[model samples]
Target chain A: MTTANPQTNETVETIHEETVETNHDDHGHHEQPPKGIMRWILTTNHKDIGTLYLWFSLTMFFIGGAMAMVIRAELFEPGLQLVEPHFFNQMTTVHGLIMVFGAVMPAFTGLANWLVPMMIGAPDMALPRMNNWSFWILPFAFLILLSSLFMEGGGPDFGWTFYAPLSTKYSGDSTALFVFAIHIMGISSIMGAINVIVTIFNLRAPGMTWMKMPLFVWTWLVTAFLLIAVMPVLAGAVTMVLTDKFFGTSFFDAAGGGDPVMFQHIFWFFGHPEVYIMILPAFGIVSAIIPAFSRKKLFGYSSMVYAVASIAILSFVVWAHHMFTTGMPKVALLFFMYCTMLIAVPTGVKVFNWVATMWKGSLSFEPPMLFAVAFVVLFTIGGFSGLMLAMTPADFQYHDTYFVVAHFHYVLVTGAIFSIMAAAYYWLPKWTGHMYSMTLAKWHFWCSVISVNVLFFPMHFLGLAGMPRRIPDYNIQFANVNEIVSIGGFAFGLSQLLFLALVIKCCRGGEKAPAKPWDGAEGLEWEIPSPAPYHSFTTPPEVK
Target chain B: MTASTQSNKKLITYLVLGCLGMFGFGFALVPLYDIMCDTLGINGKTATTAQAYDQQVINKSRTIRIEFMAHIQPGMKWDFGPTTNVLEVHPGELVKTAFVAKNNASKRMIAQAIPSISPGLGAKYFHKTECFCFQQQPVDGQSPADFPLVFFVDPQLPKDIHTLTLSYTLYDITEKTLGEALTGPQAQGVTP
Candidate 1:
């Protein structure tokens, strides 16, 4: 409450006044970040919206987790008990959609909105109003998607890929809603990406060079670019599906002279980069966490940045690898195979650099670092599976099977989602001005690590045994693996509740935190006071 | 250099690796592009109604009747999906069927369903079919992928262009792979 400098005091007062006017558009001239529940409904502040996105993402994570439980449950004994085949399919389809869009993506965006301006010493987002709108649109997108499940024919039973004829000729009425919902989500993503792009370009402090910015910021910059480019292609693919289903176009028809295979071509074009869109930022997050805890600069910093971008570029060329079994010619198979395998080169650099950063360093096993270490281990497992799948011949055995499911769940749930959980733990003190319950956080971490592996690993065995995906029921021979997979799924689902409890408990009230919670942490972000101000860096900080 | 300058240098060092990545993928493009085009069947002619259709396998066999007109190729001997058909044949092997495609813009357009009839499980190869006898002939006046109906004779002449009729009752071969091509596996996790 003490301001030694008149200029600093005056600037705060000015920021407060302008914020009040902005509040008129938000909570309508209310003081103090719009206190009541109404604040969430009527707040434009980047920090508030960022918080909203984080919470929403976590909630959806649970919902998606429960669906995964159903999958695991059904697999538990091999007999179809917990849910029906069609509904089981709905669970898989919605589970994939919700976790990817509703949870992980939003969680990262929340972190970015909270961190980017602080890291670069900017006042707020580049386009504040659009940021608010983007956050608001996601809930509606998911609602429409979820509601489609209970619809007469079941929600989007065509698998997340929504292959044509299957989607066009056989899909239920709710597909129209699914198409629209995806449309809105894409709009939200594109606008959100554009805002991030502009903020990074124009609003940095006077001397924060691009190279000087943190790795998290750099990876997100690339991530945002990937978003802008591919979100549109998703929109295009879905639009073609829309017309083909209802409007009578033949974009994916083999009979009307259109090749159904073209559908995979278009979908994966958006899809491949999208997976990178999820992981690139995680690469950035782990890069930040490892260094802060290790008391060392990131190993091979330039190499890390280059590796992240390289992965992004390569994402586009590997799209057709997903379509290898759908009747493609021989040469295209090899090309995708080779291009896909080559992607591992840059990815390998990233993994090596993470380990090298930890080598011989004074590493502390803090909660964030614990999760990061788990991420490196498990995500690597996922990555290795990906490499295996990349072998064109090997993929024949893996594609559309639980093995494919197992691979992505590791990369996504452990790789990306784990990083987001780590980011929350690392920054909670800074955001809440109070240290969270560490005992609870460590509980959440250990539980998630053990449970997540249990949840995803057994599927690999089943998949290798030739169990296909997207089917509601399986033959009885697969009972043992299904049972183990289901038990693992429930354990993983329950573990996430601890994360929610820790986060909520911190937000309510806790022991006061010092501004720089970690001594080794370095960034413009750490320089700011704990519970980062409604507006940090009203005047930008110097780079050095 | 100060630590800051050194760190900045390290960042730049890695960025060059990114450029290497670009070139790396750029190298894979040509061969990958060729593979993508070929496997996707982008180069093969789109199977037209006239191109003789292949026959299907009858497992739990039941007679399913299918009625559609196709432009029969003159020289190519093709079979429909199933086996029962009576062609109104003329002396010159005169090919007869509906060639004009009615564009019903108001409702769904019904393209001619070229029928394919062959042997049951472990039956003879789907070498030819009655309905598939229709071939995609790029007639002098027709549009893209359009083929005129053509029929040939063994030293027999009936080229009057009329009264030649081919008819066949198609059996159901649905849910069966008409045939498996040499395409490899479906690549998983291509999504970014």
Candidate 2:
């Protein structure tokens, strides 16, 4: 119910609280709740906020997953199975929105809230109250969005990108609400990111220098900066949409001295960075886990840091790759094409660093390692496809096709989601004070890996055959691929059930976990007791 | 903790003022937006800066469906309907066009087509919106996209900025604009 604030010379909690003395003058335990519902509502503690974020995102993940289920079922057949074409379009749009905003991103934030302070030997986040507000705003924002589906003309059917003219001229009456909701979501994200950047930059313990920080924290620092940079641009884009739709201004209208193509320019400028925002934390997670399971010091540790930084810098310029097929000038296209291709070198460095980290060092394929290994293999596959997509001429063929769909899913599902799964397994013992069932974890991983590939791999062929994306219905020529994709989707969806069961069962109780479960695990976090105390390192841990 | 003491009061003040400003702006935006779209809602009708007709036209690797309109007087029904379908011409072959224009109005109506690019961006590289092809063709029609736009000129047309709207209701080979119009006559004019 209360934040744990350490007293400094300038602002002393003890002096302030004693000045307005109550029955309990103790600052630490002052008027906290009766320990049940009150704990969550008025809580400013990092652990509490982290738990709330995790649970909220989990619930949203299921809701988003259900929407995906409806979409896959509809695409299960040649003709539409259950919903109207427009309704089907809404499902695809919402599913993506929920998954991106509501699921993958939030999960990482939750992990950050819990682990960052512990990892760096800080007592709490730099701005704990703002952290609470950031977590709280998301549910309401999503509520406003999901509720729009029932309004007069229905919710956003203009795809998740909300392209103009369609979003502006043809979109339904509820679009105003959509804009407002996005504005709120952007606010929440910006606040959360600012808090992360401040904490990572300023709040690390005395000896936890930049180089000494864990890979996960380093990547988050970069991701937070990316969020700060791009979320505003997204706001700018949506603001333009609002003006074009409602006001006389024509930022996107060609006749209004505006260019709809300009909207893409602005959008991908934000979006290309957004893709990395979702995955860089995953990179941090895999970097952490691979070394722990390999029983060795991370090979080329400093090189890994430099590689991540370089990749982040490179991400800013390569945004035009997404706009390659959007009728940009030829010279611009050539520039972006080469610039986009150039990202592979830095990305390659990280992959090489990871492989070298695990090279011939008493390697163990625990559940975390299984997911981390899957992340490397599948993410590389996604990366290879991304390189192919970077080619200007080939991009023309692949733009907005199922190939784009396959490409992003590999990155999002296997890259981001797999890392999350790995993080859960990697840190479950530490969090729950109990070991998770490894057999169940393995079952979850294998089923997911197999089904995910089954779901996404065929999309490449379909895309090559010119099956366009974001369409509710396909011609009979694509019937088989669609069917196979549907089955894969179903299997992937079902595989998640095993994961849910395993996580919940572990959280309840299991074999007792030790303080340092992995032989090679070396971090401020592992040095703490299993099931970390609510108030950890009130006095900063002396990092050696 | 040290950071909070310094930034906390400033942060709270900023958030409160920010919220008030946002609320005020949010309420004001709806009306402001409505006015802008109505007055300046780009219907894509603008004067064509300049043009050249390549009558000899040798670059016919592909055939394109095009829509064209001519202004006539209201109540003056055209004997022939709109000419808005594909006109197939051979590479380097000369092509010509004819459009019926009549005046059935009691007063004279003057009109001019704003500048435009044809085939749009849809033809080349397909930026879709950046093609810069929406022009307000001077037409005495109900609207440009309705086709065979049977209309009358406004006698009060100003000499300065005589803006007009011309929308070409493009239909795919299998699709017909007439059917689309019947579905629910969405106003089509200059595309913004």
Cα lDDT tens digits, model 1, A1-544, are: 2533654445445544544455566556443575688778766677888898888888898888888777777767766778878888788888888989888899999998899988888777766777889999989999999998877888987778887767887788899999999988888877677667777875676568888889999999999888876776677778778888888676665444455656777778788999999999899889989988998989998988888888999998999888887655566779999999999999999999999999999999889999999989999999999999998888988998989999998999899999998899889999999999889988998888887877789889989998988777788888877877777788888888888888889988999888889777888889988888776776666575
lDDT of 2 by residue, B1-192 (tens): 334445644554554454445435433444454354335432232332222333333444433333444333223333223454334433233334433333233332222222222312221111122112232222233333221222222222222322332333221111112343335544334321
DockQ of each: 0.04, 0.06
All models, RMSD in angstroms: 12.7, 9.6
Q: Please name the candidate that would achieve the greatest TM-score relative to the true structure.
A: 2
- Quality of candidate 2 docking, DockQ: 0.06
Model 1 misplaced regions, further than 4 Å: A1-31, B1-43, B46-192
Residues B60-175, candidate 1: write the lDDT tens digits: 22222223234322222222221223343322233433223322123211122332221111011112222222422111112212212343221122122222222322222211
**Cα-based lDDT at residue A285, candidate 2:** 96
**Per-model CA lDDT versus the true structure:** 0.71, 0.72
- How well does candidate 1 reproduce the true complex, by DockQ? 0.04
Off by over 4 Å in 2: A1-34, B1-139, B142-192
